[model samples]
Target: MRKRAKKHNYTVIIERIREMVRENGLQPGDRLPPERVLAAAFHVSRGSLRQALQALAERHIVESRQGQGTYLLADFDSVLPGDAILEKVSEHDNVLHDIFEFRRIIEPEIAALAAQRANVATLNQLKVLVYDQQRALFNNNEVDQFDTQFHQLLVAMTGNSVIAQVMQAIQAIVDTSRAPWLQSRKRRQMSIEGHLRIIDALEKKESDGARRAMQQHLAAVEQFIFDNQ
Candidate 1:
């Protein structure tokens, strides 16, 4: 009974920390409560309290920056969603498909521009992005932060700040979608393979090939989107 009670106590403490974070409107860069203070307030050992924080971090609700402190993650939930509307908002929506359409127009141009102007370092960065993504997908880390870097680096190669900004505006939706889209058996097998073809075209300075490869890749995205429709 004592052990069970202790478990319940820690769970309650974790919930309290979550509430405090929301109450303060904390963001990704915002520091969380210091360990000693929070543990003291909860009348719990630092070890148990850290475990609770770890749980929250895994859910992307918080983050810890080295030498700084634990931070409240900037995320969808930080938008001040009321509890009743939260679950409803998570369901699929058409906004993401629209973003994909936007990508269709922009991604090919970005690829073409990248072919025309990307320096050796930038082209190699694209290669690394594809390779790193392949590794992540194979390692089952595809749903992690690597997906963001993969797409972002692809666009970054174009050196178009405005295009990058447009992409960043819809970043959350794109990041959220990558896992479910990639989870399709077809993509799980060969998504990286297609991306590599694009990288190869870009590296070879083949503008037309890069354009075609990018178009084909995003065409896959379009098919995925409307297929769900």
Candidate 2:
């Protein structure tokens, strides 16, 4: 009975922490209050609070970086078990087809919205990403990080938190599935060209053009994956 009561208290504390996060409007990359502060605020023992935090961490609700404190992840789905989409793709043997189908349904619209809403700061940030991608290519380095950031930034520029969260989740799945295909230089160069077109449309604030560019880009990526496979 005592163990049951303790478990119940722990669950309650976890929910309360979630409520605190929402009430605080804490976005991704935001740091939580110090351990002592959070424990005191929740009126829970430090041990109890630590247990709750560990649960959240396991679920990717929060991440603790050594010497940097706990920070919320941009994608809450990051901690989803292997049985999620990643496993589905692996078991089905049509990973690229599945991922590109999802991108076709979602990313073009994301690009259109980003073109409509992106500010100068966002545009500049995207330009920097493009430059970084090009630099990586020239240096014969991997382009996966910049490519992922480029897409994520587009989703975020849409100014819709719900869409941003959904895309973040989808992207986590895409990242795991694209690992093998991203190793090809031909594919990497083609991706760089596609990114340039998308950036050009966004810079001009042409929503339709941005949408078309993204569609064409994804089509090319789909073809590359199909041919290589």
Candidate 3:
């Protein structure tokens, strides 16, 4: 059908856009090429390009400003390759429990690694993300995207490709679940506070502190979700 074909085309366009980001070495907050330029380069109609952009926008991977061009909002590297781990697992499985347990086990080590490896630029970027999340909360906007960005950034700071791949799988699994849990302003504020503590530990390059902070944060998160559910 024509509709199916159009959908396929746009999906192709979206992957092409992701490839463009990789080829260009684009970073968070980097402005993408103008819409016209992108459409021309990809040999797609402007309408098709817009559809691709809209899909990215809904994922909070990118954002468009009124006068300014669209910009990358999160690291596209967080996208998993092929079918995600969750996709292969049974739907009736205790997937959420497995994910949280994995987080509690692995993420503390990630935080410690990040603390050992954090540089001035990485710290500055983390601060900016936290600030943006705070601003979003105050403005009554959803903070789940920022939350994702913050955690992804921490993973990036570790500079471990294997860890990156693992986090990407976890990200794919939780992408659908974040918004509902984050809808509560109290939850969002708590998340920000947890991020600050982790940031502080990273700034001091305290691996033990970072590990403890991450453990506490994950515990708090798991407890909150359990209480709510």
Candidate 4:
């Protein structure tokens, strides 16, 4: 029974370990002490301690290299925020702004391309995302993932895999920005409306209209970010 509860204790152990790492400015490739030593430090059994290490390993925070030992895999900034709490990547805030500018550059054109090239099937996929987003909002649930789905689908509609790949990379950067822009009901409503307008423009195959709608939507997003800040 004692052993059984230790499985659940990994989260706590990992939590403390992450806090220490942040305090010490631990870097990538840094090796933690062996499991037994960690167990002794934390006053937890070796079995429980190994479980904590394994959990971090799964998150790309730590890596095991067979003979050498476990190594820290996450960058210093990346590891600061553990799984339970998200933090702003303060070091890359300017990069994030640049990323949004990149969005401004790439997104409007993708929307125009979508208007021209999106097949009925691709449009239906966008519709599905909108529907899921609406359902989440109605249920008072978070719409972040669903919201991202709409943009991701729009990028795909460009019929250019390269655009999709670049958009995906941008999405990853956006995800790391810490303060979620979609946690509020008001934001979700605005996003849904924006999506609807974009979809309407795409459905009509009006390139200019689609481009305008996409640019308007992104402008609104930037305003919302500023308003919230």
Local distance difference test scores for all models? 0.64, 0.74, 0.77, 0.71
By lDDT rank, best first, the candidates go 3, 2, 4, 1
Candidate 4 C-alpha lDDT tens digits along 1-229: 1111111455567767777677777788898767667778788866556656665665577887887777888863454444542222222334546656767787889899999997889888998999998998899777778887788788778889887777676677755432342235666788899999999999999999999998998788766643442
Off by over 4 Å in 3: 1-93
**lDDT (tens digit, per residue) of candidate 3 on 103-162:** 778889999999999999999999999999999899998677898899899999999999
* Weakest 10 consecutive residues of candidate 1 by summed lDDT: 1-10
Query: What is candidate 2's CA lDDT for residue 112?
Result: 97
Reference-based TM-score of each model = 0.52, 0.59, 0.58, 0.58
Instruction: Output the TM-score of candidate 2.
Output: 0.59
- Pairwise lDDT winner, candidates 1 and 3: 3
Could you give candidate 1's per-residue lDDT for residues 31-121 as a string of tens digits?
A: 8889898899878877557656654565566676788778777543554344422232222334445656666777787788878876888
Better of 1 and 4 by lDDT: 4
Judged by lDDT, which candidate is best? Answer: 3
Q: Kindly report which residue pairs in candidate 1 clash with one another.
A: none
